[model samples]
Each structure stands twice: as C-alpha cells, then as structure tokens.
Target: MTEFADNVRQAAVAMRALFPATPMQRNAHLSAKYDADIWLKREDLSPVRSYKLRGAFNAMSKRIAENPDQQLFVCASAGNHAQGVAFVCNRLDRKGVIFMPVTTPQQKIDKTKVFGGEHIEVRLVGDYFDDCLRAAQEFCAAEGGQFLPPFDDPDVIEGQATVTMEILDQMPRVPDRIILPVGGGGLSAGARAYLNALNADVHLNFVEPKGGASLTAALEAREPVTLNKVDTFVDGAAVARIGANTFSVLSDTAPQDVLLATEDGVCTTILEMLNIEGIVLEPAGALSIKVLDDLRDEIRGQTVVCVSSGGNFDFERLPEVKERAQRYLGLKKYFILRLPQRPGALKDFLGMLGPDDDIARFEYLKKSARNFGSVLIGIETKSASNFERLFGLMEEAGFVFNDITDDETLVNFVI
Candidate 1:
C-alpha cells in the first residue's frame, strides 16, 4: 500500500509540469447546509475541466517513454474523456485519434478540436457509443496505435490517484468522509485506493446515477454485471457496466455507502448550485452534492469532501435540466384538460388558476366529441403546493384533467 502511495506521489510530482494541483476549497454553502465541515476538490477547474486528462496523460506518457517510436494514441469518447485525451496529446506533442458517436454534441466536438489542435484527428463513427468503441478499437488495431481505455486500464487508474494525492496535500487534515461520483468507477477506485493506502481515516461514499447503478448491481452480485437499461440524463456518471478492474478495487468498500442518486436529484443540485452559489455544474458533476441530503445523518459534525468531478457542461442541455428539476420538485406540471367547446368553459378553467400559477404552454390537441376538446396545458408556479391547490380548484370547477408530466410513455406520445 505504501509503495503504491509512493508511486502516486511521483505521478503527482510529474503532473506539475502540465498543471498545478486542483484546488480543495472549503464550501461554506454545503458546510452550513449540513452543519458539517465540507471541502470540495475542484477537478472541474482542470485544463480539460475534468480529471480524465490525468489518466490519459499518465498512461500515454509512460507508454511513449518505454517506446519512443510509438507516436499514435487512440480513444473513443463522446464527452470529457475525448477532451482529456485531446488536451494531453496536444500538450505532449503526440498524434491522437479521438472517435466519438455521430450523435455527440457539436459543442463537445468543437471543444475537443480546440484542445487537440493539429496534434489529433477527430473521427465521427457510429450513432451509439458502443458502436463508436468498436470502430475505434478496430481502427487502433489496424493502424498499430495504442488504445487508451477511459477508466479500466491500470495506468489510468493509477494516474487518477493523483486527485487524492492533491486532496491530502491541500486540506488541513484527513476528512472523516469522502464522497465520490462513480460512472465506470475510475475516479472512485483510484481515490479510495490512495486514501486506504495512506491509512487515512476516511469513510468512502460512492454515488452512482440511479438510472445507471452499475456499482450497486456489482456490489449486490459480488461482481460486476451489465445493466439492461440505463438513462443517460446524467451522461457523465451513467455507465451500463462498471469496469471489472474498478469493481475489484471497490469490492472492499461498504456496499451500503454506495448511493444511487436520481437524475432529477442531481438536476436539483445543478440548479441549486447555479442559482444559490453561482456555480455551474454538469449533471454528473452534481452527483456528490445531490446525495448530501441522504447522508445528512452520517455526515453531521464530520469533515466531508465531495469531489466535483467535471464541468464541461453544454448550455444547450440547460432547458432539459430545468424541466427535469421542475418536474421532480413539483414546481412545473403538464396536464391534459378536457374542456367543453364553449367560450365561458375556457374562461372558467382559466379562473381556476391560482394567482401564482402561470401558463407556460397551451396547445389544443383536438375536439374529442361534439362539445369537448382535449387541451394540453403546462403550468409553472413558485411553490409546489400551488399545484395541489390548482388541482383541487380544477376538480371543484368540474374540469377533468390528467397529469402527463410523470408519464414517460404518454409524454413522448402526446407532449
């Protein structure tokens, strides 16, 4: 363990040539919210706005040092990892090929290009990430290039440990608890291993997106298993399968501490941090903060550290994030109201709305019968309880309504 710690320290020293240690600043908002000492390791402030660059740089550097003639590095990623690999390849003056799904956002592709400049080539392959992975690997093998695994590789995991090294160096003392967001599990495994290796008195808490609870599934089966379905709302931390190597390291941690956070819960945190703290966080970056309410009992009076992993958030998705948060908080709702095709009928329904309620959407579906029409109405209010009152008023006024906000299938079909 100590030997591994020494190696991680060496990696930290080497990383200084690229960028200084990421900050570990005490967060007053979180500390006050939980009545506990809370510090955040701001990996989001890294050159690539993520810790992924550490792994990509470390693995690539070691490989090149061993074989000077090996100049090609290849990877498949649609998000932060792509940017990370691109940034490192350009920084090290090595050639790289980054393959991303065809559906990947243009903002991300542009950012990756900006990072790689002339040192890398960006390839758009299949529509799905798995397809992109297959294409990337086949291309790498055919071209005799080194394939950089995003998280599963040993060297990559070792490099991610540098985060923990920085944490221990920056903080005044060892934290009583460390909250980590897990996707493929690289960051969590690396940070946990380093903390345990250093004999730090820290209880590790792993948080996964509820839609992609790969680590939770692995811990339950006592081994890694693939999830049949996963929601990609929290794209940064949503993985259908946890890496075998990562699960091997995580198997020793308390399974109960692995928290599966709702995507909406993470959205809530994202919006809260943005509005309340003036902090911009991507969905996955807010995972640790989202689960703090669940850990309130365990974390009170204890020093805690939450790693804000990445901030490469595209503003294009901000509307979706806001929508999800509103739905989760009951502040916004969509309903189908059956109204009689009469002028006073519409006026009566409008009068049912409370003073705080504002109509955000109004679409006439169609006339269902001789005297009734189906109208899709969206309402937004300052407080959640306003909806309850509005519903009661609608019911008392003899209007029939169906809430389709939480109905996934109906929403896709109608809304």
Candidate 2:
C-alpha cells in the first residue's frame, strides 16, 4: 500500500474510538429503478450527518499527537467543516475557534454550536467565506494556534480515505463503479487513493455541481483554476477553487469520469430520495445519486456505489427545492400574460385550466392601460403536457402571453 493509503487505514482504526463506520448498504429502490446493483456509502449517517468529521478528526488527532502542548485550534467554514471541527474539538476537549460567514444558515450555526459545546466558540466574521477565512487565518497566526483546513492538507485527505476503507470492508465484493461527489476534493482524492491501493477493479466517477465545477475546470487545465462565480445552491460542495493538494492527487483522472450536475436536477433527486426512500439529502449530498441517470445505460446489471455525502438539510429550504424540482420537471411554469380589460376575462382564463392544473400565483404587472393589462402568473400541473394544452387554449382565445419560466434574467428579477 502507498504511504497515504496506510495512513488512511490508521485513521480508520483510530475513528472506531468515536463512531462506528458508516454503512455501505445495497439500495433496492435505486437498483430496481436503474436495473443495477446499486449501493449507497451512507456518509450521511455520520455523527455530524456528513463525512467531514473524518478529516477533521484525522487532522486534529495528528496535530495534537505531534505536539501534546497544542490545545487551541482554528478553522473557517460556512457549513459541514465547521460542525466537523466543532465535534472534534468537543471530543478531544481542546479549545477551538470557528469562523463562519454571517450569512450562513442559522440551522448550521446552531448545529455547530451544539456539537462543539463549550470547547468551541463560533465567530460570525464576514458575509462571504473568503472574508471569514482571512479572519480565521489571522487569528490563528496571532494566537499561535493550529489552523485546521477544510480540505487542503495531507492529513485531511488521509482521514477522508477511511470512508473508502469502510466501503471495501462492508461490500460483498469490489464494486464495478464508485461515484463520489467532489468539493475541495479531499474525499475523492483520499477514497481514490485507498481504492487504487487495494487493487479494486472499480471505475471512479466524480460529480460536481454545474454552477461550481472547480474539479472539472482543474482537471481540464491540468491545474487548479478559480471560478469566476459559483452558484451556492449546493453550498457544501460549491467551492470556487479546487484545493492545490487535492488537484495534484486528482490531476491524472480521466476527464470523462467527471460529471456535472445542475442545481435543479439535484433538487429532483433530493425530492425523489425523500419522498420515495425517506432519505433526506442536502443539495451537495445528492450529487452522486443525481448523476445516476446519466450513467443508467452503463451501470445496468453492474454493481455501483454512490456516496450519499450528507443529510444536514434545513426544512426551510424544502419549498425552494420543491419549486426547483417542479421547474426542472416542467410541472410548473411562469408567464406574463396580456389580459383584456373586459369583464369575465379572468373567469374565462380560469375555465381553460385542466382538472389537475392549479394557479399558484397571480399578480398584475400593468394596470394603467384601458384596453389590456399585463399579468404575471405561475401555474402548476400534474403533467408537463398540461402547459402545452394551456398555451393552445390561450392562443385560440386571442390571449397574448410570454412564457418566462426558463428566462434566467427575468426569472431572477421578477420571480
């Protein structure tokens, strides 16, 4: 085994003192749907409801062992990493200072606090991650405390490799393929290294959010590249830049193995998992499963494993997830309609709706015109074809309407 893989095994052994290994269970629902032997490496079942705790524990354990006098640690994160560090700090009884963006969700902040207890103090430093990271780094330097990175260090990578070790132990045999979600690349890099060392005849596939394809960009360029802008819908995996150390390890992977998932597409997977399997997944957590559709033909009748990376979803985001899923599925649409000033016009329009069709929203965009006025409308229906029928009816009735459901600019400003 490579030195990295050996270190990962050691980390796995050490982790047993804290929590049991996450399950690698064959998923009957997914297997049936795709005609494949599908398994889920359930990292979402970890103590912090994510695989992040492994890296945090591994890194901190190594640091503390190296210098027994070291008691203070610091880190900057908006979500999972913060919770991981907090949990580790509380476990080790070490003092920690966690810096998080002010705009981070209250659910995450509360969870981190709960995990860390009195061992960690959270500082809401800035509105953005970069700003908060800077503050954390400066504090660490000034206070002579160890700085725990989210994914850039070798120890963190080794720690994440433990997940792969557990997967091999839990599975009946080597999987034909392993699907991993990439953020800063710690988990992917670590898992790939260990699996390679074990001589597992497995194909590795990496999934990244389309709006934040840092890993894809880096692999294409043969170096890390900073994205111009990132969509934070998959906040846990929405890294703007791939980590340098992680890119070095992942640099040789074939480009075809990397997949990009859209935010709305991920939402559909989340909803499906929740409604069908009772598996609640955060946006980033659904990356691998969401991309299974893209691999349907290739994975059929083959043993495949997808890392369900986290389950720390906030219920407040459920409405947004449902809306995005509906939009992607074509079950919902937004439109601007020119309504005639004549009485009963609204009633006539309502009458054209199918039995399953429902008006979710209606607003007047213009009211000054005497002959006609513009109305902003949102409608939902049981089937996507219902929109076609609705449009046809409006056309036959001489109604002028513009569908803006897919218009990004207008949707952002109006919807």
Error of 2 at 19 (Å): 0.4
lDDT string, candidate 2, 1-415, tens digits: 7776778788898999989999888889999999999999999999999999999999999999999999999999999999999999999999999999999999999999999999999999889999999999999989999999999998999999898888888989888999989999999999877877877788999999999999999987889999999999999899999999988889999999999999999999999999999998999999999999999999999999899999999999999999999999999999999999999999999999999999998999887577999999999999999999999999999999999999989988897
Off by over 4 Å in 2: none
TM-score of each: 0.98, 0.98
RMSD of each: 1.2, 1.1
RMSD, model 1, all Cα superposed?
1.2
Considering every candidate listed, which one attains the maximal lDDT? 2
What TM value does model 1 have? 0.98
**Candidate 2: how large is its RMSD?**
1.1
List, in order, the clash count of every candidate structure.
0, 0
Off by over 4 Å in 1: none
Per-candidate local distance difference test: 0.91, 0.94
